[model samples]
Target chain A: MMLLQATGLVAGYGRPVVGPVDIALHRGEVLGLAGPNGAGKSTLLAALAGSVRCFAGSILRAPGVALSWQTQRQPAVAGIPLNGRELLALTGAAPAGLPPWLASRLEERLDRLSGGQLQFLHLWACLQAPAEVILLDEPTNNLDPDGVAALAAAIAQRAAAGAGILLVSHDERFVTATCQRQVLLKGAAES
Target chain B: MNVELLFDPLFLWPCLTGMVFALLLPLCGAYLRLRGEWLAALSYAQMAAAGGLGAMALGWPLALGGPAAAFLAAGVKNVFEEAAESVRGAAYAMLLLAGWGVAVLLAANLPLAERLGHALSDGQLYFTDQGHFFAALGALAVALPALAGLSRPLLLSHFYPDFYRARGRSARRLHLAFDLLVAGVLALATTGIGVMAAFALVFIPPLAAAPWAGSWRRALVLGGGLGVFAHLLAFALALVLDQPYGPVLALLLVALGAGSALLAQGHSRIAK
Candidate 1:
């Protein structure tokens, strides 16, 4: 089941930042996008998510496909005065599957949570959402070892449930350990 | 203080109208503050007031022209917001200035419009009739369910703006719809309560409640409760003290904001 295919994609803010490359994601598989800083890995994800301009490319998604995207380093939701539980509800994710470490503190404000806990809770919302396609940008930024492992488990579970997942992160080990397939995006200059 | 006067037929309708806005406008305010588009309240209110004046000059009803112009302003604002996030504040300022400019020119030329403008500026809520009272209720009726239904996407958009566009949906339409609802509500409010009072209801109470609230739902209720408290207090204070409703309401809200800020600061300090 090919869920998404992007051919010769070139995306950027106003100019090409990434691609002239090809990638395909299938149901029940995690595809990792890796590169150094400024490699446009995030840009490629944005292009696929339609949040950025695609100068040239055709992205074909299977009929009735929907995307759930979690962007990099969102401003701390601490300022929002919402708790983890409220965030999950708003994102349409359930707490039933939450790890016990997180489930106990769902009532606390997001700002009160440590960085890794907050990041993990945010990641869980996207992972648990009922979307055919999931796009994650730097999901491992502040996660501790436990949080990272929890994320890896959730990713696998989501994949098993038939989502086509696109993962972008600088944590090479996490990516290498988690994704079934990997794509390296050379920066626009090298590409 | 002659409390019985508040229930007098003459004052009852306007008081009821204020109560309706007190409860409803804060919901719009919370979302506006969340979206960082609080300036839209002033933009929409001023534009609607200007539009009302323009309608009066043309010998037509002010209500129709007010919302019509607000919707138009919402379109213009949409263009600016779409261009970049950085310019949202600038767009709101521009809209406010344009409305102020047009309103000044219209008032200068039309004698009748000048009087109406003063009444609108003074926020003569006491003079509001049954029609104005019902309109406030009507705005409340439309805004509540609409805000409730739009809560998910609106909340998501605030948290992760890319969520909807990634799902291949135009986040702008949701924004514009919200803007239009605010504009309509503010338009009716501006006509009843005056610009500053209307904007106050949409600004201060939510602000006062946000700091203490533990959840989004609680903040909403607290904000509404605060708005009602302020409105009734301002209404009573104005009646007893012989002050005008608009200025009194605006002052009451400012006091609330400042008091809340002080308390929140003290709490933070105590925790430290």
Candidate 2:
């Protein structure tokens, strides 16, 4: 089934920003979004996440389709003194109790977690959510090679488990390795 | 009828109603405070004032029944305040101040005004020494208990554990329930414009306590205690000075704000 179809999407800041582009995501598809700086990658992702208003377009999706979004910066602070399990539980993504192995492994503070571990936890939170599509904006921006590999592995696992993945990234190698297809948002068109 | 009206159950009813309103407002304030929504409490007080005024103008039927009427009036106030605060402090202040101004203008008919004033606790201006004193006392007695009960919840909701606890919980339901209860209680106690008197109970203590209170409990307790003291003292002062009680309470609140700032400075010095 077509999970999300964005037809004739014309959205941006007031003064002719970006879009007039079309995109579609189907069940179990990994679409990599590649673009340069000021290329409106983040705006596109935001529009898809429903955070940005759609100026002109029809976004059709199946009912009960949840979109999990990950930001470049950790959206929540670790200063609130909640461990991973508690945070996950609070977000309603995980059960109040987890298996011993998973519970023990995820006990690290969000700030204290290694880049790779934080990446894994972020993905884990998304994976555990009831979302059918995962939207990641620069998922591996701060990660090292190993961290990126761990992220790639996690995404692979998620895609295998029947979830659509949409991501915006600059790393060509990472995109080639993970994404089933690529869409490049080129420079703005003439008015 | 004139001599017996003094001892009539109807006469005493307004006093009892005033006392009950005094109690319910702080409960409403505490609930809003716990939600970390001070602006909400202020908004509710303004709303209550407007509704209470309107009810008084309309023959004051609600106030006749006393506490239950006061509660409904308070609920109307809370709801209006909630909507006002959702847009921020400016909207809330404008509504409250504008409403008070309109009420004053509406009470221009001296004879009708006198009757309405008597019906609604003297349009928030209890001029006599005893009337003012009871108001002050009532303000304190009502505020203290509600603060004592709801302090924990209010404080916790702002900090760590409470934040986590509120996660995924439907706090709005709890809020609506409390608002309804307050309104019901207010309805029972208030008559005519006297219902607006609840504003003194709802806001003064928390506002004064915010900057001066060292801990949450201390803030709530001190705020409630001082609110009562300032109110009573202000009312007494108003009677002695031949001033309006509403303006007296308002001025005292302003002074309390200044005094709290000074006290904060002195405390800091003593600690040093």
Candidate 3:
């Protein structure tokens, strides 16, 4: 079943920044959105996530479908003292399938974790959250090779669990490796 | 020292009101500090003070007028949500300045202006009336449970508002609800304890507790405890030394907050 369909979508902060583009996601499919800087990849994701204003288009979701979005920038966790386990709990995500090393450190404060560790942890929270559709932007930015591998595996697992995934990334190799199909966004004028 | 005075209703009511302020303001402060809206508290306090002073001049009940004015100020702030951060800062500063300006102008015209102005700046907690006490208590009643119920979501929203929104929560509404609550609490405190005391209570405790707390929840609890302890200690000192309650309490909180920050730094170095 189609989980989300965006037809003739143009999204941006104020002025039309990205598209008159068409996109759709089906259940259990992993769709990669890739483009160069200023391609409005993030803006497209934001429109789908109902964040950015959709200048022109329609976003249709399957009835009662829920979405989980991981933005390019995670919120600052300093001084919060929340641990990985608590973060998952707050999001209603289970730690059952997380990497062993990551699972073991769930009790540690989020700020105490290295950048890569924290990134994966946050990604896992979004992936494992209860939602029909998951949106991830620049999930590989701070990741190491191992973290990237772990994320790819997790994405596959989530897809296998019947969730539709829309991933936005600039990493060509990773996108080609993990996504079943790719959507390329061009600059606003070009498109 | 007149220990008997401490047992009197005049002294006891203010202390009770201060205790309530100590309990509520720190919780709001913890979230404000986390969201980088610490200045909003001071601005709201000033607006509430201005409202209270205006009420006094018009012979209206301060309990109603102060909250109304603070809520109006909060509404003005809401309109600036999309403005640049610098613009928002300017808006807050302007509200504070306007509040003080209106207060001073009104005080100058009133026969009791000198006394009223002193209370506005320094606070006259000892002169708290039954109406102010009940109003503070009522605010506490509403604020405590509301904060307790919303603490987790509020914390999450502060850090990841978009994430919270994506999860089907209205982050904007949550923010507005929080601001309104803070404004209400400020109105009560400003009318009862004065602007200086209210501002000190809202800003200091969280700062003092920030260094040692491992989590936001712990920081809030610690901050509330610190606020209560400081209020009590300062009250005792004021009674013995016949010093002003507001300045003494504010100074004590500042000293403690600085000490906490230093201690946290020392502890971090030692751990390293």
Candidate 4:
């Protein structure tokens, strides 16, 4: 069944930065959104997440659908002091399938983690959340090879469990390997 | 040392009030520090001080004017939702300076202006009246549970507001509510303990506890405990050495904060 459908959706912060684009996400499908900088890849995700204003078109979600979004920028964790496990727990995300390296360091402070470590931990946080639709922006940024493999595995696991994922990434190899389908966002003017 | 003075009715209320302030202020402070808005406390406190002084000059109650001024200042920030960061910083600076300027100007005509200014800036906890005491108690009653209830969401908002928003939570409202609470607490505290003491109590203990804490919850608990200990210790030292309570307490809190930072450094080194 279709989990989320965006029909001729136009979205932006202001002045219509991206879209009039169409996309549909189905259960168990991984859709990759690939674009260059300023192509509104993040903006499109924001539209899906209901953060940006939709100037045109409609996004229809299945009844009672929950969404999880991981923005591109790593949240400022310097003073937060939350650990990986605590973060998952707070979001009601189960820690059962977290990568062993991350699972072992669940008690370590978020701020103390290496950039790659923190990135994957945050990705897991979104992936594990109980949601029908997941939106991840640049999920592979700062990730090492091992971390990327872990993430790809986790994504497959979530898809196997019937979750729909809308992933935005610039890494062609990761997207080619992970996503079942891909959508390319051109600059707003081009679109 | 006159030990009996500690048990005096005049001292009893201040001590009780101090304990209550210690409990709530550090919790608020830790959260503020987490949000990187620690300066909000000082800015709000100064606005409250100006309000109280202005009200006194106009023959109104200090309490009414103080919190009103603080709420107004906090509201101003909310109003300028789209203001740039530099603009917001400039606004805070201007509010603080203007508040202090108005306070000084108002006090100029009064005979005890210099002393009153000193009390507002340095604090005069022992001189707090019953009204101010009850106000602090009331603020504590409201702040403690409110903070406890909002702690998780507040923490989430501080670190990942976008995530909080994705969860269908209103991050902006949560921020405004937290800011209002801080402003209210500061307003009451400024009236009772003075701005200097309020700022110290709200900022120092939380900072002291942060380096040692593994989590935000632990930091708040540790900071609250540290605040209370500092308050009581300073009160005792004031009695022993015949010094004013506020300045001594502020100085001691700073000392404790420094000590904790050093201890945390040593602890980290040992672990490494």
DockQ of 2: 0.04
DockQ for all candidate structures vs. native: 0.70, 0.04, 0.58, 0.63
Comparing 2 with 4 on lDDT, the higher-scoring candidate is: 4
Q: Which stretches of candidate 3 lie over 4 Å from their true place?
A: A189-191, B1-10, B129-131, B167-169
- Estimate the lDDT of model 1: 0.86
Write candidate 3's Cα lDDT for A39-78 as tens digits: 9998888888888888787999999988888887777887
TM-score of each: 0.95, 0.51, 0.93, 0.93
Ranked by DockQ from best down, the candidates are 1, 4, 3, 2
Tens digits of per-residue lDDT for model 2 on A1-191?
Answer: 77878887766766435577788988888899888897778777767766556777767766777777665655433222234654454334673333343456665545445555656565566555566777777877767776677678777877777888889888889999999998888634557
When 2 and 3 are scored with lDDT, the better candidate is 3
Error of 3 at B89 (Å): 1.6
Clashing pairs in 1: none
lDDT of 2 by residue, B132-207 (tens): 4455456447545644544443333322232223132333444455555444433333332244445555655565
| TM-score of chain A, cand. 4 | 0.95
- Quick one: best DockQ, which candidate? 1
TM-score of chain A for the candidates in order shown: 0.95, 0.85, 0.96, 0.95
TM-score of chain B taken alone, every candidate = 0.96, 0.58, 0.93, 0.92
> Interface RMSD values for the candidates, listed in order?
1.5, 10.5, 2.0, 1.7
TM accuracy, model 1: 0.95
TM-score of chain A of 1: 0.95
